[model samples]
Each structure stands twice: as C-alpha cells, then as structure tokens.
Target: MKPRISMITLGVANMAKAIDFYQNGLGFPRHGEGEQVAFFNLNGSWLGLYPKDALAEDAMVDSNASGFNAFSLAHNVGSEAEVEQVIQQAINAGATVTKTPRPTDWGGYSGYFKDPDGHLWEVAHNPHFWIGPEDTPK
Candidate 1:
C-alpha cells in the first residue's frame, strides 16, 4: 500500500455550512460543484465534506455518535505566529477555539479548534520539523 493519504473525508452535519466554513472561512480552494458532496484541494491531498448521515450509512455505521472521535487533524505551520494566526482564522470562521495557541511542553507552539461538525483541528508549529513545502514562509 502507498504510504500517503490521498484525502480526508469529514462527515459534516450540514453540507452547506461545512462548505462555507472550509471554503470561505479557512480559505480552502474548493475543487468541484457537486451538491451532495464538496471537495477541497489541499497542498498535497484533498479534504472532502459529505453529509453525516449519508457518510455513516455508506460506512455501515450508526450516525448518532457524539463527543470526541478520539483523533485530530493537524495543520503544521512555519512559525509560532502562524499557528496563532490560523487558530484565529478558524475562530473567525465560526469554529470553537478549544485551546488558545501557546508554547507546548514538547517544544512547539500549538492550538486547537473544532469545526462546525465538531471535528477537531490542531494548528501547530514545531521548530524541529516541517511537514510540507507549503508550510514554508514565502
């Protein structure tokens, strides 16, 4: 199997709301105009949004799950300042700020936010690591 993630599909409670949050609020460039689902082109992968119930049905799981899903999606940036900026952007885009950006015990800076559907996202900056070329400051 390839050691790369091609896409991350999020089951959103509201398609339109999720689309606006990612496309307009977080500035993810949307890829297509499909109403049933929305796709965004990321730096190296893709982010997909589909209705929660439909996604659960497709996966043959119950859709009534709530609370933490026990995982988080991370966005690594080039600097501590960038981490804060991204977190604030998410907040302004209607996300709930779960943790304000701060220096971490692991020697990095990071923060957390939850999207409209309660999907947790971490915006972070690690001095020792860089995830991708897009994380480089221009």
Candidate 2:
C-alpha cells in the first residue's frame, strides 16, 4: 500500500546475458543474480530479468498465444513474514498464486503471483537491501 512503485522487474529470456547487458553494456550496478533472474537497483526500486515465457506462464497466459498481459509490478515490505502476508493479501484480492513462498539462494524469502489483470508480481524480502521511502524514482 505504498503510494509509489517499490520495484519493477522485466521478464527476460537469458539471465546471464541480461546481467551482462545491464551490468557491463549499460553500466548498471547489479546486486544479485542467478540462473533464474537478475536484479539491479534503480534509484529507490529495482529492475529484474526473468525468462519471457516463464513470466507469461506466471501471469497465467500462454506466451505462445496472446492478448494483453499487463505489466507485473512489485511492492517491497520490511520482513519475510510481510512477504507471506502480502502474497496472501494478493490472493484474497483475486490474484493467482504462481509460486509458493520459499527461501532463495540469493539470501532472501520470496513468492510470486499474478494480479487480477494477469500481471506477474513478486513479493520478496531481500535482507541485503535497505529500500526506504526515500528511494523514489528520479
């Protein structure tokens, strides 16, 4: 329920390649990355890269087939329990659960779902980050 976006993630095909493009080619500072995704701090939020098709699936739409799959957005909270709570809230609000909450190798707890419009959203708690209200997009 923040008034502004806390993070924005882009679904990409290749994680390493996306990382290289953002970290090297674009000179963006990446904080963490793995086989599945890559994230970069952008002002007060984040930019993420994930597999395109997988993202579509998360949104419950066929990537091979199509209509408008609205953009997936994120809202970060302060704790892991908050992540779980938000996921539940999302579900009760009519979002579909795409992935169960779990511990991640990048040292955080996270879960995924799709909004009413079928946009993918991730509720996560990254201990390494200290995203505050001051972290607003420029």
Candidate 3:
C-alpha cells in the first residue's frame, strides 16, 4: 500500500459552522463543498471537514462521546506571508483564533487556532523543509 495521505478529514459538530471557521475565518481555499462536507486545498494535501455524527456513524462508532483526540493538523508554508495569510484567513473564516502569529524559538513563524468543533490547526513556516510536486510528507 502507498503511504500517502491525499486528504485529512475532520469530523466537525456543524457543517456550516466548520465551513465558516475554515473558509471565512482562516481563508483556506474551498476547492469543493457540499451540504455535508467541505474541502480545502492545502499546500500539498487536502483538508476536509464533515459532520461529526455522520463521521462517527460511518466509522461504526457511537456518536455521543467526545474528549481530547490527542492530535492536531498542521500546515507548513514557504514564507511568512503564507503563514500569516493562512492564520488571518482562518481567523476571518470564524476559527477561534487560538494564538496569533509570532516568531518561534526554532527560528520560524507560527500560530495555532481551533475550528468551530475545537479541532486545532497550526500554520507555520519552516525553512528546513520543502514541498515538492509529489506532495510527500517528511
């Protein structure tokens, strides 16, 4: 099997709210959208949001439980502009701005935010990595 992720889908509480958070708040490009799901064009991957209960049902699990899932989705960009733009776009899209963009100790610029469903996302610029046409993750 190929070890590659073409998309990462997050189960959200409200589809419209999640859409506002990711699309209007943070400014992720909405490549495709529907009543139940929305898609964003990431640098090398795709990010998707869907109804939480539907996701749980599809996974054949109970839909009533929720707590820390222990993970966050992150985005690595090529420049400060990309990072800032994404962060601000997320904010405008209705994401609950968790942290404003700032300089990092690792010599990079980054920030964090949560979607309407409390899913965390990070936007950062790392000089050490590169995003190629093939879209492989390091």
Candidate 4:
C-alpha cells in the first residue's frame, strides 16, 4: 500500500470555536463554508475539523471516551528559531504549552502544545530531517 495520509480529522467539541482557533489564531487558511465542518490545507495533506459526536458516529465509536488519543500531530520547521517561533504562535492562538521549546535528545530542538480541544501537537526542528516539500529528499 502507498504510504501517505490524505488528511487528519480532528473531532472537536465546538466547531465554531475550533474553526476560530485554527483559522484566526494559528493563521491556518480554512476553505469552504458551513457550521458543521472546516478544512485547512497543510504543506502536503489537510487538517479537518468536525463535531466530536458526529465524528464518533461516523467511526462507530462512543464520543464519551476522553484523555490522550495516543497520537500527536507534528509540525517540523527548518531551524531551532522557527521551532520557538511556531510554539509561541500556537500559544498566542490559545494553545497550552505542554512543553517549552528546548534541545532534544534527538540532536534537535522541539516542543509541544495542546490545542483548544486538548489535541496535542509537536513543533520541532530536526536539523537532519528535511520535512518541508522544498527540501524533502527525493
């Protein structure tokens, strides 16, 4: 099978609030119109937001389950400075800093934050890894 994720769908409790946080706070460009869902384009894939109950129904799961979802979304930048900058930006956008930017054991710098809905995100600068499209190895 091909190794690629077309989108990451976040089950948010409040659609409008989530949309505002991602669109206005983090400066993620949202496309389409409606109150039920929102879509934001990322570097290669997409970020989707939908009502938690609705998403759970679609997945045939109970929405009452909580706590860490056992996964985190990561945003990799080009340098240590960018890691700091991105983390600060997320914090300004109503994110809670779970970990302040610092040197990592992986020989890079990284940090983490929780979005308004408590979805964890990691912001990192891996000097040895080129994550962005322009620098990604062929």
Candidate 5:
C-alpha cells in the first residue's frame, strides 16, 4: 500500500457550523459549495468535514459516542514562531487552546487546540524535520 494520506475526514456535529469554522473562520479553501459536506485543500493532502451521524452511518458504526478518540491531527510549520501564530489563528477562529506553545522533549516546539467540533489539532515546529517540498530545510 502507498504510504500517503490523501485526506482526513472529520465528523462534525453541525455541518454548517463546521463549514463556517473551517472555511470562513480558519480560512481553509472550500473545494465546493455546499452545507452537506466540505473539503479543503491542504499542502499535501485534503481536509474533509462531514456530518457525524452520516459519517458513522457510512462506516456502519454507532454515532452515540463522545469524548476523546485517541487520535489527533497535526500541522507542522517552518518555525517555532509559526506554531504560536497558527495557534492564535485557531483561537481567533473559535478554537480553544488545549496547550500553549512551548518547547518539547524532542527539542521542538508545539501546542494544541480543539476545534469547534472538539477535534484535537497539534501545531508544531520540528527543527530536525523539513516541512516543505523537496525536503528542503525551512
């Protein structure tokens, strides 16, 4: 199998609210026009938002679950300052800061935020890792 993630789909409780949060608030580019579902083009992948119950139905699972899902989405940046900037951006977009930006044990910097749907996102800057195309150091 190819080692690539083409997209990450988030099951949101409110489709329209989610769309507004991602598209308008967070400035994610909307792929198409609709309130039923939303898709945003990322640097190397895509982010999708769909109704929670509908997504669960498509996956043939119960949608009555809540709380942490033991998973999180990450956005890696080019610099430590960018991490803080992104965190603030998420906050201005109505996300709650779960962790303030700080130095990490791995010698990097990172922080966390929870979107309106309560999905966790980690914004980080890894000095040892190249974040852009062609593996070029940022």
Candidate 6:
C-alpha cells in the first residue's frame, strides 16, 4: 500500500455554499461540473465536498454525529508570515478563527480556523521541515 493521501473529502450540509467558500473565497481551482459534488485541485492532491447526509449514508454511519471530530487538516507554508496570511485568507472566506497565528513551542508558527461546516484547519510554518518539492528550500 502506497503511503499517500490522494484526496480529502468534507461532508458539507450546504453544497452550494461550500463550493462558493472553497472556490470563490479561498481561490481553489475547481475541477468538473458535477452538481452533487465539488472537487478542487490542490496541486498534488484533491479536496472534495459532498453532501453530509449522503456521505454518511454511503459510509453506513449515523449522520447525527456532532461536535469536534478530534481531527484537523493542516496547510504548511514556507514562512511565519505566510502562516498568518493563509489564516487571514481563511477568515475573509467566512472561516471562524479558532487561533490567531503565533509562534509555536515546536519552533514554528501556526494558527487554526473552522470552516463554515466547523471543519478545523491549521495553517503552519515549520522552519525545520518543508513539505514541498525537494529542490525547493524553505
């Protein structure tokens, strides 16, 4: 089994609003025109949005689950300033700021925000590690 995540799908209660927030708000390049689902090209991976109820039904799980899911999606950037920039972008896009960008104990800077559906996301800058191409240095 290859160790790679090809996509991350978010089960959204409002598909149109979700699409707008991701596409128009965050400036994610969208792919396809399917009415039931929205897909965004994330450079190497993909971000998908699907109806919450349908997603739960497809997984054969109860859709009544609420509150924190105990997980967060992170976007790593190249610098501390970029961390704040990305967080601000999320804010302008209707995300609720959960944590303002600040220096971390791990010798980095990070922040958190919740999307319209309450999906937690972290924007971080790690000086010790870079997740992009090997030729690119942080």
- TM values, all candidates: 0.94, 0.48, 0.78, 0.96, 0.94, 0.94
Which scores better on lDDT, 2 or 6?
6
* TM-score winner: 4
User: Residue-pair clashes per candidate, as listed?
Assistant: 0, 2, 13, 0, 0, 0
TM-score of model 3 vs. true structure = 0.78
lDDT of 5 by residue, 13-68 (tens): 89888898888888888898988888999978999998999999999999999879
The per-residue C-alpha lDDT of model 1 at residue 64 equals 97
lDDT of 6 at 118: 97
In the range 12-131, model 2's lDDT, one tens digit per residue, is 656675566556654658886566877888766677777778888899976675555655555566888988887887665556889888998999888888653356777888888846
Q: What is the C-alpha RMSD of each candidate to the true structure, in Å?
A: 2.7, 14.6, 3.1, 0.9, 2.0, 2.0
- Relative to the true structure, candidate 5 has a C-alpha RMSD (angstroms) of 2.0
By TM-score, the better pick of 3 and 4 is 4
Q: Write the per-residue lDDT of candidate 4 for residues 1-138, one digit (tens) a residue.
A: 989999999999889889999998989988898878999999789999999999999999999998878999999989999999989888888899999999999899999999999999999999888588887666
Determine which window of 10 residues in candidate 6 has minimal summed lDDT: 129-138
What's the residue-level lDDT of 112 in candidate 3? Answer: 91
Can you write out model 3's per-residue Cα lDDT over 36-104, one digit (the tens) per residue? Answer: 788899776898887888888889988887787788888878888988888777766767777888889
Model 1 clashes, total count: 0
Candidate 6 deviates by what RMSD?
2.0
For candidate 6, give the lDDT of residue 106: 96
